[model samples]
Target: MRKKTTIEILLFSLIICMVLSAVEGSVPILPLDQVKAGMKGKGRSVFQGNRIEEFDVEIIGVLKNVEPKKSIILARLKGGILEEAGVISGMSGSPVYVDGKLIGAVAYSLGTFVKEPIAGITPIGEMMSISEKRKKGPVFSPQVPVKKHLTLDELFMLNKDFFLSKAVFHSEGRALKPLSIPLVFSGFSSYAFEQSRSFFSNLGFNP
Candidate 1:
């Protein structure tokens, strides 16, 4: 009887450990409907020196249907490095939590020259949905030559669809081309820059 009791206790302990492990791995997300305006939260991001720090988040309100069925969380941030430098460009994907629940990530910047840092939070649900789709789909595979010898007209013809899709037209009818990615070159020759510009430009990238 003692041996059977010992076995039962061991099984119970094992079951408890398994339950705790599952809980730890799963991050409980707060539903968007539950989030209210004027609620306070904390955001985590790496500011400088590779250390992730916390900042204060004051909820303004949720922007519903901003992007065709997708919504965003609008919040005013205070404290941390925001006091000195406003919103850092590389701070995107910084996870935000409200009431100890995961809310979203710091995705959009309101303005550059503004004194206060106001940002748009891409909801955690949206991000998770994106991740799920990516996991289930085949990865993107691009084919490109080592040296692109295509002319400007040829390049334009080949990538016209991409440029058209990315092109943003303002109210004044001015075409605002979106930069695919930002590249920085330090101490590189002007000739090198000019030569590489075609390659990058053909690949729908901004150099």
Candidate 2:
């Protein structure tokens, strides 16, 4: 949800208050792990949109609406504390672990206004899918493969470089084909990408 809206900010404040108030005298739970669907857990969050401190909450459900988007988690206030800390802004990516297992991350914040403490969460598996991709940067081959042994203008998808996992290496290579004789035009030319063909035509080039 867009964070610029005023209503969204207010909704976050309410949830933060709910969680913080519910956990009174109770330790605020914020553990880290891989979150999955249907995992029950809790979190502590502070809502900055309004005056509120860390609050606690219980997760109900995990949802996936679109790929690459944060997961949605369904939850409600436990009916204890102030009822503000249940869910709040800046709580996205909050870790949800159940039975010592990570189930997901916090995703829901105030988008459209609501009455009670309610929010969605992102699954920990999806979060891992993202975190796992961060490491060692992109893999680059030191040496170019021999010509005739490679294909022209081929595309390759970069694989994840896991830091904690054991190293796994594959002996694979790619071929780079020439897009022009001077090679200078290729540097800034449309052929640099798939849409270049159309871009060049827009530049008055015939096919």
Top of the candidates by TM-score: 1
The backbone clash count of each candidate, in order, is 0, 32
lDDT of all predictions, in order shown?
Answer: 0.60, 0.37
What's the TM-score of every candidate structure? Answer: 0.59, 0.38
Clashing pairs in 1: none
Task: Tell me the tens digit of each residue's lDDT in model 1 across 5-97.
Answer: 333234333533442242233677887787789999999887777898999999988877654546777788888878777666666657789
RMSD of candidate 2 to true structure, Å: 19.1
* Tens digit of per-residue lDDT, candidate 2, span 108-191: 443333334565554544445444344233432324322233322121112211111111111112111111111123343343
lDDT accuracy of residue 196 in candidate 1: 54
Model 1 clash count equals 0
Least accurate 10 contiguous residues by lDDT in model 1: 169-178
What is the Cα root-mean-square deviation between model 1 and the actual structure? 16.5
On the 0 to 100 scale, the lDDT of residue 58 in model 1 is 94
